[model samples]
Target: MKNRNYIHLFANCLITKGISRSVICDLQRSKYVLIPNSFADLFSKQRYYNLKEAPRIFDQENLSIFHEYVAVLKDHNFIFSCSKKELKRFPQLQLKFEYPAKITNAIIDFDKNSNTTIKDIIQYFLIPYNCRHIQIRCFEDMDSIFFDTLITEINHCFIKSVEFIIKDSFEQDYTQIMKWVENNRKIKSLVLHSSQENKVIQKENYGFGIVVTTRQKITSESHCGIIHPDYFNITIESYTESLCYNSCLNRKISIDKSGNIKNCPSMKQSFGNIKSIKTLDSIIENPDFNKYWTISKDKIETCMYCEFRYICIDCRAYLETPENIYSKPQKCGYDPFTNKWKWDYESFTK
Candidate 1:
């Protein structure tokens, strides 16, 4: 029946068009599929098309490609068969996102010489402005006692999730790492950077678990942004937030290893020192601190044309043009115009 022959992509399937290619972002599954630009154009022009009307749209030669696309889309569950009247039931995906916390995420950089304490940070943040996520970056190899005290402090706090990034060493306490991760539901990921080998170790019960990354010797904030497909997060919250705010800097604040308070540790501008600032309220409230929070991908130069703009974690700290705030991330090697990555993109399975 022609009534049942209508085909439509689900609302969650966000088709982001590049110059020559398009990405079908499946928000529900946190995945994406690459499709030719022509296919994306067809889907946009006809939101819900009847199969009977396909013949007039495409010529004899290109009709086969259209059929192949339909089959592939159906198989991937990106689209579904429905009637024209049934289309109203599925409304458009909502792009507006509201985070429950005032400070959704924060980062605290540490080194052997660092003096800012977790106790100070906890009392500073308080429960009034709940920071949902916290990422702790350690430039030097920390002892087991460092985590012991930190975890004990977190156990009594209201923080939702904690990510630990430590310098890899020959004598890493795997036993303690696994023990802490297994016990705490809030401990999301433990990353060992500058490692000899690259691997992952996580269980079904544990949070994202431990990750070892090689050649990632992060001494200072200079080693911040490296755009890779592995870092992409295709989630509803991220997609909606990217529409309005900077994907990486929005609602984010940080304290560098030197006790300087900043929007991001990599940024040269410092609001104030953590030691001098009272409760971080003064710094976050400052208008200058929130300047780059609204610089979304839409305003970014080369990123605006990228299909991965919504999902890719953007970096404003290091730009191709250092003086230009709107310049693209220098580390990003992907060119949307040619639909090519600088290196061989072998990691792309889908």
Candidate 2:
């Protein structure tokens, strides 16, 4: 194997910090493997050695061990005998230093008496360059005309998908709303929260992912939270190196009922007031506005060694240690050291 001369790592593969080990991810293949610390140390040198040279350099008594390891890496197509220039032909993984906006989604909160128009909200709070998902929460009753205006305005903006959550007592002309949802492709989902009964209708296959459900009243405590493992996994995130592991904070913005812009609705730090800001572009451009966007799971406390680190939705607003930004999530009881997850749904509500 040494006669093959030079060997190099695949350009698409990424190395991430792991717990007493290293994680090797092939971003192009969407595959990952955990390697020993020894292998990581050698790889970190950036000098890929041939199979025969590995035993000589590491002084391993068992040459078979090194051979087996190389064979496994070769089988995964993570190593190549080709020259460094040949690997350069493949697209190099790059991380962005200055992203357009850390906010990929924007949450718009509306109370019973909110008079803010859809046009004004999109123009002032929505940064078209980075925002794609929009969640509109209405604690008050909203009629079809309101949705019509919202759908029309969102259709004209750069927002690709929208989810509307309204209270059950709010009467809406479903026929008109459905028609508008079908007409405007951006209206992707609708959720109704009821204070009385518990019922759910599955219209996920419709033009709009519609779910009319009954739940408790909307309060600061009532929140629907979940983490999608598929999109949040390391295999997928390895390709998006610049963004944070928390998808919610990866280019995300939220507007409160008072039209204050924040990292999230629960966060107290207001970047700026939407009504007073001329454009959201300037607000997002501020370094302080995106302070949390770079805090990946590996940088977090207990999350660093967790298998679910990438799949977990993080809450920067609440922490196990209030003063520490790297503290574990207050709601999570996961012990990565013991490989046990004790998170309870009841605890999540608080």
Candidate 3:
């Protein structure tokens, strides 16, 4: 309190939540600081710090301890010594709100044998303003002619990424698949599913794209990838108060095998067919369509106590209790109360 002139929060840092759950994040440094509850009062006052106010916040008995705490913050660059003028000029940190969208990504079930043209698929499903990415599921192997046509049509749409989930027989046309990847730079992920049992698991990078070959059939769960500890976590949806629940459910949509458009293929309800004039822009405005987007992990049973709640992606498609939309994810075996996975417990019993 006595040594430092003034303190200013770093430009990249943000203090979110109240004193109880205050989180300091440095966006530039990608660092997160969880302030302890004991220093809650000290941090509350430090938001507006000066020599005169320091004594009032931290009385004579605690002034020395407060000074030491500020010194540590300065050492870690959480707060820096600055002039009063500089402190005033520092940008204020505010919370960010995630808004609902008309479309973000889509899953289109493409039948290779169907008479549907690549141009027809894009025109019917992709609304340029909303759609960004799409995953195409092909039940039959896509021949060179069909692959070429599809790639050309998709490129015209200027979509960010295209994931191909193809079901091939025992023998695969690797040369043709590689050619397709080389031709279309937007092909981010190519997964080949085989009907027969596959022994070895392998993955390879074809330039910027990835090719994964598996023996198992592709499911809705496979569409979602592994979760990691990153700033853009799927679980952070719990914090949003907006009706648009999860990013995946917010203005996100899918076209099932029958060309029935829904929020997701796993969901039973369908807005309408792609051929109809009922565009995504119009359907998203329906209150019923936006219902699931707000179902965050905090509201989920057993998920509130789990540490991974803020990091894991929510699953509305498959719930522990099918009838209950707010039920815990069926695939998640973790028991937050017991702090043990059901799989681990079963193995222990054996």
Candidate 4:
């Protein structure tokens, strides 16, 4: 058999002790594998000289290994989850990429007494940036009034799309929700989230509104889609995770939300502060940060071998809570480790 030139490795806290041992053994056996951090730096130096070299192995191990290899690499890699002090040490760690305007949208979860006015914020932060759509989540007290105001504002600004996520408690006033949808016929998508009690409202009016039920219960008759947010858990193969990451990156949406902009909302590291820079273009210009974006499935260990590597989202959220992220989403019946879709089997096998 030909020597397997590629190997993908993915591990979280939940892997059996034996699994970790097996993975480490495999890494030791690879011919020219590159660890995670060093791979970033290697890519950066090559890019400067207009050279390209295929990195053999991508290591997705713990932070210790990442830090150890990073220290030795001459080039700087974009640091995810690093504090401002740490980033200052590597001032050359910035990179840039072309921004995608189509999918660059914003979601604002509104609470009472939020210092920022929703309309003003959308106008200033979203509209000027040419953001195509905006999703708003509001409390019950403000839903009715705010909904009207938001619709007026969207029309005034000629914004293309708007989605409102209302609390489930408002199921009784289904008519009002329908009326809003009816009035805004040009809106591309409208989704309503309701608790179990309000599920009936969704069923009664199937034409205008699409209801998403968060509750686990299955009603005898259902007309709308059900989304149990808790069911989104699952252990995906490393390749599958990389596929997801690449897909997200290709879309040009910034997921980083900690102190600095990185890849995902859950990652604690920052290459640089977005507030100070005011644009992703500047961040992407940094060579170190550019290397971070260039990281491919071949560079990451767990993503190398998995068959599903291209379809699933490599979630940093799962990395943060490995136990929960690795496990099947509470609402999902699939096992990530085994790459089995139990829900599909259970539904069809019977």
Per-candidate RMSD, Å: 3.2, 5.6, 6.5, 17.0
Q: Order of candidates by lDDT, top first? A: 1, 2, 3, 4
Q: Worst ten-residue run, lDDT, model 1?
A: 341-350
Best by lDDT: 1
Lowest summed lDDT across 10 adjacent residues in model 3 is found at: 234-243
Across 1-350, the per-residue lDDT of candidate 1 in tens digits comes to 54678888899988988777889999998889899988887778656667887898889988998899889888888999998788778778878978887678888898888887887887786355688679999877887688778878887788777888888774544665676677876777878887766666454344455545554566777777778899898999999999889999888888899989888899989988878876767766788888788899989998999999999999988888999999998888898888778752233211
In model 1, state the lDDT of residue 223.
72
lDDT by residue (tens digit), candidate 3, 1-350: 33556776775554443313445555555455555445544446556456557877767767887777667666768787766766667766443555343566777776643545656656655654447678878766667576677778888885778887777643654666666676678888777776454432234455346666776655443343222233234222333322135634655777777767787777788888766643566677777787877776667787655544543466677677989977876656666555455653223324
List the global CA lDDT of all models: 0.81, 0.66, 0.61, 0.40
* TM per prediction: 0.92, 0.67, 0.65, 0.45
Score residue 173 of candidate 1 by CA lDDT.
49
Ranking by TM-score: 1, 2, 3, 4
Better of 1 and 3 by lDDT: 1
Better of 3 and 4 by lDDT: 3
Highest-TM-score candidate: 1
Error of 3 at 14 (Å): 7.4
lDDT of 2 by residue, 69-161 (tens): 677888999888865455445565555434454456788888756657768776655655556678999776767677777777888887778
